[model samples]
Target: MKVGVVTFPGSLDDGDARRAVRLAGAEPVALWHADADLRGVDAVVLPGGFSYGDYLRCGAIASFAPVMGEVVAGAQRGLPVLGICNGFQVLCESHLLPGALVRNDHQKFVCTDQRLRVESTATAWTSAFEAGAEITVPLKNGEGGFVADAETLDRLEGEGRVVFRYLGANPNGSLRDIAGIANERGNVVGLMPHPEHAVEAGYGPGTDGLGLFASVLGAGLAAVGA
Candidate 1:
């Protein structure tokens, strides 16, 4: 499987995301923000970092990038897309997923190994995990808080769209401790944690995050019966 990792001007973890994809037994396709094409990749990843210097708001500027146009369309067609950290912000800004990410309650950048529970395993990126399973991954961001209106929150909960939830403690004050979420179609997902950074056992947080990448790869291969 070929997974495209998009790099916008201030993207910091694009390389890490590419490495994680390769480690998960898939090819990583490098994509640029200025490009409008998807290069025939099976899936797409929007890695973390402050895009456009987070000027207006985190991911506000990047949501309008040329590459995102293709991404939005691909996601609508059920092409798997994973957005991490600031990339998650972009996904929300693009309306690919509902809700908004805001400043951390502490008003400070936080970095740590956070415990999360798998709330839903039906998404393209999380099928490998069993519901209610606990996993730890690196979490780092300044504006990582997730927010939504009561009706939207109720719909997400009612529809089982919540993907990941904070386990031990809420790191960013996200509503209901939601760390990640998926679209209604389960093809597009956004999360604030850095799973790519935890794919390698000795290098980053740990190997706990490998399953996220593997899950998507497996789902893709299954679709092709490979």
Candidate 2:
């Protein structure tokens, strides 16, 4: 399998994402923000960073990048896509996922090894994790609070789209302690944590984050089998 890791200006974790893909037994393709081509990759990952200096909003400017157009269309066509940290913000700004991430309730940047409960394994990126399993990964962000209207939140909960929930205390005051979520079709996923940072043994966290990449490799890009 070939997974594309997009590198926008100021993107910090693209290389880590590629390494995670390689560790998961897949080829990692390098993609640039100004380029629209996906290089025939089976899946795509938008890694974390302060894109466009987080101007306008965390991910607002990056959402308009040329590559995102292809990413959005591919996601709609059932291609698996994972967005981490700032990438999550971009996903929401692009409307590929519902809800928005805002400034932390405590009004400060946060970085920690966060515990997350796997809520759903239906998404292509999360199939390797067992339902209700808890795993730890690094989470760092200033505006990581996830918020949505009551109806949307209810729908997400009812439909099992909530993929991961924060364990222990809330990190950034995310609604209902949500740490990650999948799209309605289960192809696209957006989360604030840095799973790529946890893929190696002697790393930020443990190797728990490797499951996400492994899940996509096992299921391919379509979420139907995942």
Candidate 3:
């Protein structure tokens, strides 16, 4: 399977995302924000970064990028897409996913090894993880808080769309300790934590994040019979 990792102007983790895809036994295709085409990749990843310098708001501008036009269309048709950190914000801005990422309640940028509970294993990006499993991954962001209306939050909780929940501390003050969430169809996912950073053993907490990439590749290949 071919996974595309998009690199915006100030994207920081596209390389890591590509590496993670390769480590997961998939070919990593580099994509640019200005390009509308996806280069025939089976899945797409919007890596974390300070795109457009995080000017007006995180991911506000990148949501309108040319490539995201295709991403939005693909996601609606059940394409698998994972958005990390600022990319998560872009997903919300694009309305592909619900909720918004706001400033951390502490009014400071936070970076740490965060513990997350796998709430759902049905999504393409999280199927490799066992439900209710706890895993540690790197979390870094200035505006990582997740917020949504009461009805939307209740619906997400009731429908099992909340994919990951913070285990110990509510690092960013996300509602209901939500660290990540999936779309209704389970094809699209957005999260504040950086899974790509934890795919390797020596670099991060452990290989816990490898499951995310593997899950996407495995699911994509299965869907396409590749």
What lDDT tens digits, residue by residue, belong to model 3 across residues 49-89? 99999989899999999999999999998889999998899
- Weakest lDDT window of 10 consecutive positions for candidate 1: 199-208
Candidate 1 Cα deviation (angstroms), residue 64: 0.6
Residues 85-193, candidate 1: write the lDDT tens digits: 9999999999999999999999999999999999999999999988999999999999999999999999999999999999877998999999999999999999999
Weakest 10 consecutive residues of candidate 3 by summed lDDT: 217-226
Report how far residue 49 has shifted in candidate 1, in Å.
0.4
Clashing pairs in 3: none
Sorted by lDDT, highest first, which candidate order results? 1, 2, 3
Model 2, 1-226: lDDT tens digits are: 8999999999999999999999999999999999999999999999999999999999999999999999999999989999999999999999999999999999999999999999999999989989999999999999999999999999999999999999999989999999999999999999999989999898777899999999999888343365
| Top-lDDT candidate index | 1
Whichever of 1 and 2 has more lDDT, that candidate is 1
- The C-alpha TM-scores of every prediction are 0.98, 0.97, 0.98
Model 1 CA lDDT for position 35: 99
